[model samples]
Target: MRVLVCDDEPLARDRMRRMLERIPATLCVGEAENGQELLERVPSVYPDIILLDIRMPGMDGLQAASRLSESDSPPAIIFCTAYDEHAIAAFKVNAVDYLLKPVRQEDLEKALSKAGRVNKAQMLAVRRETGVAQPEQANAKEREYISVRSRKGIDLIAVADVRYFLADQKYVTVRHSQGETLLDETLKELETEFGDRFLRVHRNALVALSYIEALEHKGNQFYLRIQGVEERLAVSRRHASSVKKLLQSL
Candidate 1:
């Protein structure tokens, strides 16, 4: 089985690499210093399991694992970190294992033995636990995940995937990169919750400003073209001013 190690510190990575040599039938495929680098390597290396550190410079291990779980086939995640506070929360997410540093040879072997593929549900749980802001924490962060029902049970989509939310009577259709999802959330609630990320293009629609490609006009009616979405959403006259202002800011 192939194993990938990700940690910011060189010594931690080296130690994990040396321990991998002791595990039977295991190959140390690669090592990454940060989450972004780890993501870039996964497509090429296709490691069966990843030894991910919880604390890092930019993206934390939890956030990184959340993104990885969205893939068609995600690698088994074993969070190896110095922090003990995150251990209980880790198991809630069904992580293969959580090894405290310095990770022992026995611990590494045990973690790999029970390692299994993690899904997005567990990743969402992890995201919720990690995203909580303490009273002392400066950044009072909102959840990065939006839970929606799918054929594969509850699919937790990264907010960045959402192109827009259009309210249709009782339901709100979330148009994302992959496809649209009918959710129970109200447009007003969504607008209030994600006001910073999304913009009201119409009374019935809240479009993600990050995905807004350009605003177009068709026979005196305005429409919005999104980056990854095919359908162009109609921009109401009431919101055209705000949309135009947003384009100017962008």
Candidate 2:
């Protein structure tokens, strides 16, 4: 597992780095002087876990942790603080564990052992505590691909390639860059998971916002013109107003 050490004090970071070396299974991938540095390095380092210090110069560990938690994929946090008074607050921020500073080797080892490598499921559970539903939280990241079975084998369809999903009786037709394919998932589930990129136009259809060309109102009916695909999808009267609002925002 890749671990990131974050502390303003050079000596504190050195001690933690040395202790981490003793555990050959884990690698100290990066180190940051303060919370600001930690945020800057996080995207590049992509550490599995971060050992964060509570009090920092530009930004505090708690503030940094909050911002990190909002990320599509946030690393697990283990806060190291000198003040015991911050223990309750640490847990409130969904930290894996809090170690009192001058952190002890035993405590550090214990915390590391608790969460060897946090997965999306673990992160979803933590996000649930903050009132986001576990199901939606699990897919906070715009899913890069959709797995669909083809005549040859399974195809990994890029989400960006998909123009729209039109539901049939039991299956959904995925109209994409190459053509169309069948998907087993429901339109409602796809609407919730990819809400940022997709907009539900009808009861059975969800179209990609990026591919939307224009909205037309003809003979008291509304239709959506999509990019690449010449076929226009009907927009239900119930959803036409909401779709217009979304399109206007873009």
Candidate 3:
């Protein structure tokens, strides 16, 4: 398999090249110092996979990945970053995997294997023979996942598994199928990103539209009954009417 390494540091690029040499049946097609250089080299190298760095001097990996996603056929991306915070953003661009810096050989091998499988899926898709989903479909909110820091490193919780996001003071708790986790982002930012899938039932809460089983009123207060949960979230009067209308439409 042909691979391209893109990083701002020469030492980092050299290190990645050495790692690729150790992996059998893999060839390092080219190396780039930054996103701009990477774009310039891709047409010539035609790499099957890209080892991309998140932070760069010009046109970072995320921006470059976005541009790549718009192409007729794009290479599978594996983000190699020092920070875990960008994991969510990485997957948003359809990254095959997120590997932290000082990457392990076993992890690289696994990610490459996944990328190879995805490449085959894309090929089948081109022939109109398979319904396998491609990475570009991740642009939609329904295909997106939320990344959170955990004791075991980063955990990607599917947006579909999420029930609601309730904010209290500084932290926003994400309630999902696997329980709850605190997300670093704000409620307003989440509302903007996932407005179509999640409804603002109150100033401090955003509930998944698919999970809303019923909206009830008791003692002049509106409450939302969420599926699979015993706790009822209080809906403020300001958003009660809009919530009701949305429920009717659903």
TM-score of each: 0.46, 0.49, 0.51
Candidate 1: C-alpha lDDT = 0.73
Q: Which stretches of candidate 3 lie over 4 Å from their true place?
A: 127-250
Over 179-223, each residue of candidate 3 has an lDDT whose tens digit, in order, gives 899998898878767665566788899887556666789999999
Residue 221 of model 1 has an lDDT of 92
Q: Candidates sorted by TM-score, descending order?
A: 3, 2, 1
lDDT of each: 0.73, 0.77, 0.79
Q: What tens digits encode model 2's per-residue C-alpha lDDT throughout 109-223? A: 8888775535334444443343322234326466789999888999998886788999999899999989999999987788778755566788898887556667888898999
RMSD of candidate 2 to the truth, in angstroms, is: 12.4
Evaluated at residue 180, the lDDT of candidate 3 is: 92
Runs in model 1 deviating more than 4 A are 116-250
Using TM-score, give the best candidate's number: 3
| Rank order (by lDDT, best first) | 3, 2, 1
